[model samples]
Target: MAKNQRRSVTVTLLYVFFIINQALTDGPRFVEPIPNVTVPLGRDANLPCVVENLGTYKVAWIHIDRQMILTIHRHVISRIPRFSVSHDNAKTWLLHVNNVHKEDRGYYMCQVNTNPMISQVGYLQVVVPPNIIDSLSTPSSVAVRENQNVSLTCKAEGFPTPKIMWRRGDSQEITVRKRKVAVYEGEHLNLTRISRTEMGVYLCIATNGVPPSVSKRVVVDVEFPPMIWVPNQLVGAPAGTDVSLDCHTEAHPKAISYWVRDNVMLLPTKKYGADLTENSYMAHMKLTVRNLQATDFGNYRCISKNSLGETEGSIRLYEIPMPTTISRPTEVRSQLHKENLAKRNVSKISQEERVKSKMMSSYDSDEINSHREIENRHESGNGYHTPSSPQLSGCISITRWTFPQFAAVILNCFFYHCRV
Candidate 1:
């Protein structure tokens, strides 16, 4: 009886030892540690849940935030196409997310279905690259006058709020807050008292330690008052000839140009012409004078006006005299002789002198004899002269004979001179 009882105790001890050894060797336990995962946007992510001695107890993955079940063992229970499941030898259970987005970042729970569910949680951190928002940002190109203030803004969105940096696109130094800096860090860029050198393209970069940084190109246009330049300030042209005047101008906000003569606006007419052409920020003005006259010679101003200011460039128009030819001396002598003859014919006779001369006395016989002698000499030289009487005749007879004969002879001589 004692032998039998010892045998039963040994058997019981062996059975208890066998049971303890089985319990130590066979049970589901996590073999690999679940670690926190970090992934960039638009990339694939993997969450590994590994087990050892995992028998029929299936492994399941659940999203903690929404309490949504993602997978059970190797089968995906989630309706989303991006969520998938895979395992190797019932040991490694992987939850795969293809093309992960910002919303995919959260805590994922890996649970084992035992008598009471056992679970381990790991956090998924999704990092996103920078993206620039166009609507909220300022204009891509802006125009501001010199010596004025201007502000630029950059807006961006990302997983982590992106930081904005301002830099010159041409690699030049930038002015910020009245100080010159190579690279400025801020969402708002303020420039005070802008200058001509500050006109260029600016780059606004947005970054948050993510791959593929984004940038925007912004152009800065610095405007100023209209400035005029004329190559020839003094212009000369001959009368009855065409003349053209030109003036070049540079300005922003575009300037309107016209020609002004002596402060009077010159319009396009049959004798005057005006033309204007524009290229970028420059304007070319031309005023053409056809059939130029003496009155057209004066100071001409090219006036340019804009929203900023107005300016003028002046040009002088001078008249060139017409050349004349010299005449012969014979022509001048003939002209003088014709003028003397006209003057002699238009002279009036004096009535007092005629009456006194007609009543001659006998005491003047010597003078009368001298006159008769001169008359005889003239008659001997040419047949055109007539001889006079030596003695004085009656007043009525002398007046009648001399007056009629003298008047007829004078009329014949005047006609003969004009025909010659």
Candidate 2:
């Protein structure tokens, strides 16, 4: 009798302990953060919810959007890769799903164990195929000086993979494309020994079974053979206030730009300059010369070309004048323009420059003062001059631009100045 009484007492004590533990801080329960979620086709996704005062209340995951119910997880839930439960800060819960199928697209619910409380809803959206890119861009469009390394790429992103093709405008003197025996990524069309004939519009086509195929045009430009330009530049720049250079082209078969110093491509970072407008052929290409150094001096050009022609313009970037006082930053940019404007007139470049003259006119300044101002302020330490003039607005209208798109630019000929 005594032994039985002691056993009964021990059982009662254990039961009391269990009740106390359950009644602790598991006060109220709630879920938060997401009310909706978006997912792409053939990709993994995660849905999260939380439970507060999680003592007495347990968390459960459920499908709230589906016509038929789907339970993802429970306190004593199943453990599978397609679905897994997790906790954060020992409070909230989450469900992750891999290889999301089409039918798996719907709303989910997160509920906690409580009285008349504890429920949250989340929606999932599955993105279909045939997405179009708004527009295209490239690194830089330079008139290659005389002779230098010409590296360029065509970058595009869409639902379907894009196919790139190169062609010329005026003449078809392009380097004979070696019939390929193998497939290569971007590297197949190498212009290591590029000339004027290797310039044109490199078209990028994105296609899927859906309606019309989407495409992006990239213009390539080669110039000057590859030489030099002269200007003062700050070698090093601060984190937030870094002055940079920009290159744009209105040519087909886009141009490739790089940041070369001591015969090397310089990576743009906190201090060093960078090759801006990357992987774009037909549009604008820009490079930011960072952490300016005296050695970064010499000829810097916007080299660009296509199968029909090649062109380059030199802009020499020298070292910045060290700070003599604390001023509000400064930059000096300068441009050299003349009435002659080279209509293929230079004896050495008569045949070539003439064909390129119309091409160069797009880059030439009708308001020579404005371009000169851009160049003058560029070299001095007076700080960067962001063009905020109403004349040069970036408001993009839906209507298509024929020559601007074909030329790789839309020179803002605001009626104010009216330069033909």
Candidate 3:
């Protein structure tokens, strides 16, 4: 009976002690549900695990997908330097990741060892920003010719494949398929029938949900044949004066320009000067002529030649005569009258000589003398008087008189006179 009572008392006391201990002890219970976390690449991340009644129980962190232990209590088990453990008293445990990477993304579990292991899982998501891949993208500078087709490609890499867009560096709208598009969306950009206006810097932009969009610069060069223009095609300069001729041109690959005159190339000399200046694709050519002369009056051609082609513009030089004074009206009239009178007299003498030469063979000298006397009297009234001479009277009479009857009567008198 004593042994039974002792056994029964010890059992009762042991039961009471077990009940007391049970009332004092508590199993690990989560203070709140574990929440999912997100972090950007190259940043830090914290996975929190809060528990109550965690006395005498150790907290562990594990990578669930990798089936690897990361932290036990306050010590980190992973060899990776970025992995660590932190705690706030006995109720809170945190798994810290420094400089998070894409590989650190996935489920992480917080587990406690007890009668049966208790665990709560949370996910860590890492996002990577966009970045341009220079090696695969188009070159920084590209050269092509006008009216030719050109294509450019832009490449980028990111956690999520990046979207590429093309725009003008000046922020102007881009031209695609003859239509103006605010922004071109594609990895490849093609330009057709390119012209000098299309030559400039282009921008390739890459972006996604991540922050800090990236961009690259590409330059487009459009080459073409040389084209020449002259502001003044016909320039004039006076003798002994200085003159300048200007020629403007547009070309690619820098055309060789010069001045030529009368199929001969002109060089800079004391009398001639030439200069060339360049502004982008346009070139200004100037030719100066000093001490201009009559020989300088001609056509001058400004020639520009390049591998693509050649062109020329012409300027003409001319001589301007100096002004002269006019003569008085009276002097001009007197000179004109004298010239007219002399012509009339010469005509009369020539006609008279022709008649006399023919008639001299037939007519007698006495008859010719009487004819001359009558003509002298008629001519004396008209401001023309001839001196009389007996020997030359017949010849002079024939030249002065035109009537036959008067000449006959005069001939009778002359015959009588001759006989006497």
Full-model lDDT, candidate 1: 0.83
Q: Over the stretch 159-230, how does candidate 2's per-residue lDDT look in tens digits?
A: 344444433333353343444322224412455566544555544444444335554444666543222232
Clashes of 3: 1
What would the TM-score be for candidate 2 when compared with the true structure?
0.26
- Residue 183 lDDT (model 2): 29
RMSD for all candidates, in order, please.
24.5, 39.9, 21.0
Model 3: lDDT to the true structure:
0.85
Top-down TM-score ranking? 3, 1, 2
Q: Against the unseen true structure, what C-alpha lDDT does each candidate score?
A: 0.83, 0.52, 0.85
Q: Which candidate number has the best TM-score?
A: 3
- Best model per lDDT: 3
Give the TM-score of each candidate. 0.57, 0.26, 0.66
Task: Report the lDDT of model 2 for residue 59.
Answer: 68
| lDDT per residue as tens, model 1, 285-399 | 9999999888889999999988989999999999877666778889999999999987766553355445434433322443455457657867788443444442332111122
